[model samples]
Target: MRVCPKSTSSPLDEFLHHYMNGHDATVFIRGSRTPAKGTPAWIGALLSDLMVPVPFPSHSFDDVIKDFSLTDVDFTLPNLFAEPGSPEADPKVSGTIHVVAALPKQLNFDINVTNIRASANVSYQSHKFGELHLKKWHAANSTKVHDDVTGESDLEIYSRIKSAPLTITDSDVFSEVIQEVLFGNGDIILDADATVDVKVTTALDLPGDSLGKSLEPQISELRIIESSSAAITLSAVVNITNPAPYSASIPYINIHLLKNGSVLGNTTLRNVNITRGRNLNIPVSAIWAPEDAGLDARKTGVDLISGYLSSYNTTITAKLHPKSIPACPIIGQSLSNISINATVPRLSAPRDGHSPDNGSKTGRGKGEFIRDATFHLFTSTATFTLVSPLQYDTITLRSVNATAFWNHTEPVGEINYDYSFDAPPGASTTPRLPVDWSVGSVGYNELLGAMGGKLKLDARANITVAIGAYEETLWYVGRGIGATVRL
Candidate 1:
């Protein structure tokens, strides 16, 4: 309280009491001598042995509110499961804490009092809440999470209070204590605050086999079947263990044949079933026609027949969806789609007991083939006698050039002819001319036995004859024979 020296009374002077308590007042006393006028009118007071017993009223949740049917606060280390210690030994916790002030007094600490009087300062602290800011407030975030148990929002709040009236109550008869506290009329409520760190992690649901061991699905027993010049059929068996604890079913299995990573053909297998921890085998096949191969079926067949002597690469990829669970969900299909690829390097065929295939020899298979590569070629000459009655003259001197072919398509390489005589156009009675030609290795092979093991080379000969100025030209196609006889 401050002392005003110059005393005067006015309604305007009442404003000075605005800053003072109701117990405070403005008192005026006359001085023995006249006080000095025009003083620097500052207010000050001095007193000795003067003390006011201001009831310091401040309250908070007791260490543990037993009367309110509450529980002992607890704290534990986050994520460090199975720690050895007394979680409730500590009076205050770092996580959520429920504070209950005794019954019937601002349950969640809401206090209302008017015509308020303040004679002192007040302060309080909740060590359980500490100074850390609140992170999650059940009441503020979700209405469903807030109930009578969650007294307030638990939002962070720090208040420095001063000059609030003190309410005095009987501590006992036995309840006079709240009467001596500040704004003591309110309900007792529970306020929960959690401070510990919370964490959540997610990963694949496939834990492991029933034995709790890891597993990898497998495919085996691959085979090639019914392979021929016209088409190739591949058959393979697939097997997999149901790693999960539940029965599994595969609705479909799609197998693709890939050559150097390109698709050749694909086949699907359906309705593959499996029991938990057991093997499931599925037989699958793919029939490849002429169109399925990058090369013609004949060549593809050759490669297969030759046991892939030169070694070509092929890979088989299996795509499937396995349900590790029975139809009852929560246990669902295999966690993800499954795919496996196995490479069959240099696919080879068996070579034992080999014989010529009907198509291989006859060239009449469902596929096209080039001519066979086995034959002999030879060239010889034969003479023809000219016997026309009108022209009985024989020419013994003449020259011949020839070319020949066998089977209308194969060229009988060249011609080598032998003659008995050589006659000039005007000369004596001798007939016929000699020519040379041949049959190539290819022709010989096709006609070795095909053309009666013999070849006939033919050519056209043009000759001009002169009988003392009566000159005329004669042209004829000539023929020669070659035998592919054994020595």
Candidate 2:
């Protein structure tokens, strides 16, 4: 049809002759035309039209072949929930799908589809797993030529599916997938068969449209509220900075706390409203279970505590699992692949009605557990002001083995206290512990020379502390300790 001569009749004439006899015909015409010598030659065009004498049945066009496929499938479910009276309050998943179609030259034209509703069966490892149902969807743009060699066009459409109702058609197979994701390489392939219903419009002629922000979540304050043999309860004030202008009501969100790639415990947030720019002071409770993660978990937990007390920055990861959001398993399954890491804020200083110099200087800062220390030289004893890192629970000092030092490295005295004493919530003074003097050392001589006066010393201690039934012994170093030499 590209070389059809201007002198020839319209190509529709041949179709008209066949149409009156109720037949379809394919026609091809090529013309040879010579232009004026030494002048540029351009081909002329033809306006061909065909009119049907009678209406054709819908099935009559079924003989025409259509080949198309879908690719670039990306699905996501935001933490947003549906409103009432619209779709079910269950969480909804949304994404875009691209369709590619290869057409013959005769039928090449732009096509637009509207009023679409579709359903698909989701399968994992050859077993039916879930269903994705779309109530309505739309594509605002027309199909455009994607590949010239194959005469293929691409159409992109987006939709928020109503609900992804999951049914574990085969429990064993589903469990295997979950087990692999948790313990193995963390990947699995899924297949889907979709059926779509839409109204299509085509034209022989054609014509010619978060610049997005993310949730910047911050932990403002963290505290140890309670503890037991298996777990410690933590309450935190989370300041979630929602940079986007949209507002959402999160009825529930549950995620697992992980340490060293192990599930330590889980945290929950409920009935929270997110708005623009810094939502402040949202109370979140978490159960920290190092016991559940194993012995190494306890060691890691101790390391975290050690780092926090030393004014070091530490972080914990909140990972989403398949059962995180119990209301919607599909959303949970989709989100379980993501791990959101957050910094564990240091514990604030206890607000007791005492200064740092309550007899001896404590140099108490945020996360500092020990407030002050006093050494009695004549009696060979020492007492310390201990700050309990708990809201309502008392911390029991089960045992103490410590050494007092002078000039950073010279030992002066040592204490070995085996009896237990309770340090209630906030600031409390420890019982005077008996110290054994290292009489021959230079530090002891310095202490003897400074009798009736106070000298700054350092102490290193292995202290065993217990809360309820949980007990852990940790090593601590105290600097600039004040010791009063008594007669």
Candidate 3:
């Protein structure tokens, strides 16, 4: 007989497919946020549930034959010892039997044999025997079995057979599989870049004047003159100009002439004039020699010529006068115009006496009796243009003024005066001297109106003078001059 293989579409096969595809039996099979239930292991759980041991079909049989006729009596059983107590004739027979019978009896016997054979076969059938009995009698006891065959004992087999669904529990089966799929060859890779921003700032400081010291004159010129026979006259002139927009108040102009390291003559301007917007010249002169001279007859002869001549180098020094007036009261007071001049004597020989006749011993000199004489006269002039002496304690604000001009045709009357000066310690009482002054033909209003009618003054005072020779006096000069406008 030919035997056919079990169909591939069996219950076991379906269960295994369900488990491998992730199906779950316990769950309601609804949409869930959890991992899907249609995994291979879940399908295996279904197969296991169906495969549980269940009752199998079984059959039992009993047989009995009726009395037979002559045909049945044809058969005979030969008892090797037909005697009593031989043990072979006992009703409970345990030995093998051999019998001979007639045809009719053989037929009857054959029927009985067939019936008994059928009953015995029924008792030994596979469906009638329990699995435990079959295992004990026919199959050998085995400790090891193929995983697929012994599904109950094999983990893999059990999972597949029961259609066990895949779950993200402590089990590492899914984890191992996922690792192999995602990172089996290598670790997952990624790449990225970063960015940042920044900012900065800075400040600076500059130097400024703290003591209020001003700039001195870049250059200066001085002159001196003297005579020997006549009354010794010394004269000097100092020229100072304001190089700044502000004016300077020179309280005194001190002039000193020195010869052979000694003061030959000295003069001071007690009340000096203030100079504004121009150069200032202060002149000083003094006489030191004899004022008159007499002729000596003993030393004179009939023709006598007597004259004296002496030479000496002269040095002149100047000082800026200080103010006795308090600075706080007249801090912004206007300056007064001033002119300074000095004179010195021009020396000459005295007229000669008439000669006597006969050359008498007491006769006067024939030519003019040369006599030494000295005189003092006006010789030079010094001028200074004056401006107010004020202290600029505050910062200069904005300024606006008309343009200034030189000639009368310029119509320059707008004077934006902004001057300042600081009073030195222990300064002199003499005032400044003004050398020159002139007013514009047009008034300040007329000039300003004609040229937009605006004026401003931004003045400042500073210590511009240098240390003069005389310690008894104070002197100062001016520096830094300019003009600007703002709209």
Candidate 4:
């Protein structure tokens, strides 16, 4: 029988002894203790000088590890009784004691040994079995490897350590580690909210009246009574709408009267007073004489006569007031209305001359001859009324009429005087009333024969009547009716 020695010293005994007795063991241990719990006196002084936070306390080895115990110790020596039946094994009775001890008496210690043995067997079964086993064991037991292993990796070990006789369970260790790792570096965080507003608008396009509307004149009647002249009058009402609410002033009304392509007259509003929403009455009258008629002479005479001849023409026109306001407001403002009425006068011409048998020389006297005449159906009055704000407005009136007349006269020698011839009568022994004188020849017959039957005369007359509020004028003419005759 063989007795195995029981080792009482721990596995860390050699390391602790070397740490205490080595030449630099004091310095090394001091360096190692630098990470121990509580502030180091010298390190604290240095941190105070730098004004930096002091490091927190660290745990000692005794505080970290506890309940260390050996569960079992086993030893085996081969060939203890191998030669019992052989000559070479005459009396070789070598034997070794085998003792199995519980390790640390922890709950997981059994599992740990089983796991280690399994890993070692697995490593040994691989190629270069010895080397692989040695490498695995060395890695598992290495101090650097043990230091690198986190408490998270030793969960089973920690769990078993809690059941050990001298082990302490650290409940806050993980939480403390997490806090230190997360807060090791300073952190910054920001919280914020945002808001915004938007606005929109729209524009509109509208229509307006810039260019004015055109104006058309309204006439009642037109007539040509003579060949070259006619008595014409225009009647029209010019209406204008304000189309606005405010008061608006009309400038003037332009009136143009044309006859046979000729501008008979042009008239403008000389007086106007137009109220808002009201109509104004204006009167208009005009007469045109033939171009051939002597208007100058007829205008000078008191009695003006005009006769209607053939091939005569006439026209009339009236214009509305133009826009007067510098600026026109919206529609429905004040506006104006105007109208005109006309009446044409009668025209006539007397016979040019008296017949030889009926009158004396130089044609019949003014009262002796019958005056031929033509009269217009309409009377001789024209009125124009304008309603607006303008102070001064003008209205024009014109008229034309033509006439022709014939005149006849006897010669001075046609009437012969009957005288008593004393000696001649006695000589003749018979008295006769102008003997050999044609019967009824001594009076107007002789005059007719002396004037070559009867004298002829021609006459023409043109009358123009221009009338206004303040003044009026007329034109006329006369002429012989036929060619002069000689006896």
Candidate 5:
């Protein structure tokens, strides 16, 4: 039957219907779980399936009508008084479905109302069915389902998985209810037994946040891929899980990537929702920009370049606070202070590709410099100047080594230089090195590519630049093709 629940101030006149034998009905309750040692039941009104459109006034979930008895819903058997001299008997059946108890103001969750749903299935049966199969049915079904429990204690209720709807049994079971279901208020108050003390968690997804974070999720891998001095990428696997029996959501999430307690990058996730007892695995990919980290990594990124594994702390800190979808019960609500830390290896690998790992003894030698920017080599060590990638006013190039390559394989002789000169403040360019290299007849055409404005230097060098947490560190400078090669 269609139910029209208008505003309470304008309650409409209503009429109501008849019930038949062997018929079924459903009654739904919206509440919380609690430590009630007594039998549990869904407290509501039992309306007839054949009732006319009923007028239900809008009221709070706790708003329950009292002493309402559906008289026409008496057990009925049509054939009971049907034929003259007929051996068959379709007896009229009648029963009273009354709204007996008023639910407590607060709801509980410990009662596992869903578990109580099981018993509602086997509450009634026909006489023949009760005599022959009722015992077996009750024996089999009762073992698995919940019984119709009636007690005057507090109750807790949960909406569906995503707090979609609070569904109880259907017609034939309990019928029309004398209660209301309003926008849910997350969380139930269960004052039952000691079955509480359950674990509820909240997670936040911040910018640069990845999977495997302690508070937000678990992940398989998180790596930094070095492509060029100006281009880097970080990849991660993020998996969020909802361990509660009901569904939940993370209204806002941001996972920040920290480098030595400094903000490097971040991953932002908004309104993350998960199903009951399920997990959400997300493959996260983001670009790595030095400017995003508040420092000129191209300049200081050189310090992080190394062939040997250097230890730097890669931490995952998240802010997990999700609001309850006011329409659903609150079990797992906003969680805060989600922070995790893990030590990671910092190094720059070939542009082809690489992984995030603390490789065996990862450190660069004297001839190796991080391939962040191109350096011009002077044939003499009289005076040399080097530049960093970070956007800053003054840059200091401590030392560097350069070597030329041919055919992408053959390496020319290598050279080393050390200096302590500072470029004037606000100067965009570094001082040119007085030292020059003589490459007679090996023209500059082969050192450049026709595809783009990129120039190639067929040389590798191990240089030292001030970067990161270190003052001066060794970096491997490999086949860089950005600026002209002045050898």
Candidate 6:
């Protein structure tokens, strides 16, 4: 009761039977006459099917090919690219790739792939972004395990690829890809078309193509840690959402931050580990150099600060520059052309780090300085209550020359103070400044006649103030300050 002609038991069946038997097929099936469970029957069917030239069904063959599809890749770039504090050097890339594929037991062979050189063009949404060059790779399936129960072989491939240069052909597309990763759903789909040349021991041609998708990393919690006239230092955390089963380690990464097409500062991440799920609390530091961005660097810097203080949303772009990878200047220079932008995190904490006092007449905003004033007619002196914007810093008043007016245009008296005094954070009263009365002026006569009354006076002053090692001269005007007359 043969299902097929006796001639179907040809060389292919003999070859498969011999191959399986050599690998202890008897352990699974004692004899073809009484095949234990279904192994021998399945083997016979597989052999009979092979007589039709296409031994594997089209769908089954497609499934097997899909099993070899690359799920993800892990790379250990040269130390110079991944580590910080290492001597800047542009060394060649040397790393191993582990690709695991499951195949039917009969397909298992001692295959060695050598001298593989491939170049792939990467595109997203029909737009070509770059070319990925696989300079050379050697692959060997030395670590393979056969599953007796499933009749499948798990082939573990170890491949080493070198000098795999990724050349960006379109920077705009690169930026769009980054934006998609940052703002879109966690995944980015990229189609890769590759042409490869390799010599396999069995001379089998396996054309491999894959649409790679990667999850976007999340960054949050940016805050100003330190500040000065020179630069502002910031700290943040990054949670790299790695979808793969493997992990990667980075020793250091430096990138430039840009604002409105101008370099704002440099950001650095050191000793980061990327693993499955969210890799949280990865520390990041950035140096904000508004003064060095462009010819109007200071203005740009001030605008950024002002925007932040005013609770306006702004964006900062990250880019690679020559100094991004000091040891690999050429690579850095090439990558510098590509940039990605993200919204700068809003500062949740108060800029002054204090609750606003609604009851206070002054210090309402950053611009408010003078609070109130008082005048002593007998002593011909006045004192002013001033508010400082700094929460932890202090201002030193070095010199002040001011004129008081009863009316906006009529000068009543003048104050000239040369001695320096420190005004700490919050509220402080200035020392009694000696006033030179204008005896003949109508404003002075009005002030003299109001012996025990309070008069609203306007004061304009040119003052010199210093914070730490920085000093600047500012002009201030106080309007409607209540001055109390005495004696």
The number of the candidate with the highest lDDT is: 2
- The TM-score measured for candidate 3 stands at 0.14
Model 1 is weakest, by summed lDDT over 10 consecutive residues, at 113-122
lDDT (tens digit, per residue) of candidate 5 on 1-487: 3335653221111210100111222233333344245534332122222234433233243333222222222211112133422222111212222222233322221221221111112122220111101111111000111225754443232211111111222222211111100112333221111111111111111111110112245554555443344445656656654333333334433454544444445564444554544365666665544454555543343443343212232333332222212221111121222334533322222222221121213221211222222334433322222222222223345775665555455443345567744532221234444433334424233433322333444445565543222244455434433333444
Model 3, CA-based lDDT: 0.22
Q: After superposition, how far is residue 86 of candidate 1 from its true place, in Å?
A: 61
Error of 5 at 114 (Å): 16
Instruction: Score residue 341 of candidate 1 by CA lDDT.
Output: 53
What would the per-residue lDDT of candidate 1 be over residues 1-487, giving only the tens digit for each residue? 2324566433223432221112333333433232356533342112222334433133333231221111221221111121222221111122222222222232222221111111211112221211222233221110111136744322121121221111211112112211222123343232223222211111211211110122233344444455453455656565544333333334433444443333445555556554556565666666544344545443443333222211223334433222221221111112112234554432112222322222322221111111111122232333332221112233332333334455444564443333335332121223322323243456545444454343343333334432222223334333232322221
- Each model's C-alpha lDDT? 0.30, 0.60, 0.22, 0.24, 0.31, 0.59
The 10 consecutive residues of candidate 6 with the worst lDDT sum are: 61-70
List ranges where model 4 is wrong by over 4 Å. 1-251, 270-315, 319-458, 461-487
Which 10 successive residues of model 2 have the least lDDT summed?
204-213
Query: Which lDDT tens digits does candidate 2 get at residues 1-487?
Result: 3324774434444443343234666555433354346644443212122223433222232222232222222222334354322335344433444333333344445555544566777676777755666655554333455576866554443333323433334444555454443344323556666665544444423422100223356664566777777887878778766543334455677789876687778888877765556788888888878768788877777776665554456677777776665555555665565565667754444676753553434454335666656677767787887776665567788999988899889999899999999998777888999989999999999988888777878778788888776688777776666666776
TM-score of 5: 0.28
Q: List the residue pairs that clash in candidate 6.
A: none
TM-score of each: 0.21, 0.55, 0.14, 0.17, 0.28, 0.45
Indicate whether candidate 4 or candidate 5 has the larger lDDT.
Answer: 5
Q: Per-residue alpha-carbon lDDT of model 3 for 1-487, expressed as tens digits? A: 1223565353433432343234531212322233346756655555545533432222111111111111100111113233433322211101111111112111111111110100111111122210000111111111112234533221010000111111112112322322332223443211111110101010111211110111222111222244443333444444444322322233333433332223333455433443433444555455432123222221221011111111111123221121212221111111111111221111221222321221322221211111111111121111111121111111121221222332223332232322322222211111221211124344333323333222221112121211121111111211111111111
RMSD of 5: 24.4
Q: Rank the candidates by lDDT, best first.
A: 2, 6, 5, 1, 4, 3
TM-score of 6: 0.45
